[model samples]
Target: MEAPHSIISIISSLLHIYILVLVIRVVLDLVAVFARSWRPTGPVLLLANLVYSLTDPPLRFLRRRIPALTLGSFGIDLSFLALWFGIVIVQYLLAILSGLL
Candidate 1:
């Protein structure tokens, strides 16, 4: 049987990867918003969609509970940043629990 700390360490690593992905997703969103004419072609769009599909479920769940920041018609989706912070904290805790910190 594997050690429990080892399992926590593995989970923490996965969460770190997810946090990185979320960062990339945020950059993509910003680019899309600011660059009105910019569009992703073939493979990039496919990967973006794939990332969106993976990340959206968690974001939607968070959005329902978390209020967004808005200025008139434009609003910032706070859930993604919230989740990013949350995962960071969780990962930190996991690192401690796993005795890797």
Candidate 2:
């Protein structure tokens, strides 16, 4: 039988990769927003669009249900941050549980 720790390690690693992808998507979106004058096209825009499509569905759904929190002129989108942190917390909990087992 496969050891529980090994299985948990595998799962955690997979989650870590997923988190990294999510972070990259967020960073790319921010960059695109700030660099709108540059006009990325062809493959670069295609890649960004693909990543946005993949990342936006869940965030849009959550955002519709949750109200945005405002701080003066800027409002924070907690839904995306919540999802990201939730994944991290889940990974940490899994690691801890796996260690205990």
Q: Residue pairs in steric clash, candidate 1?
A: none
Model 1 segments beyond 4 Å from truth? 71-74
Question: lDDT by residue for model 2 over 18-91, one digit each (tens)?
Answer: 77778878778687689887665899788777767777888898899888999999998888887788788999
RMSD of each candidate relative to the true structure? 2.4, 2.3
Candidate 2 Cα RMSD after full superposition onto the native fold (Å): 2.3
The runs of at least 3 residues in candidate 2 whose Cα sits more than 4 Å from the true structure, single-residue gaps closed, are: 1-3
Going through the candidates in the order shown, the clash numbers are 0, 0
TM-scores vs. true structure, each candidate: 0.83, 0.77
Consecutive 10-residue window with the lowest summed lDDT within model 1: 92-101
> In candidate 2, where is summed lDDT lowest over 10 consecutive residues?
31-40
lDDT values, one for every candidate:
0.85, 0.82
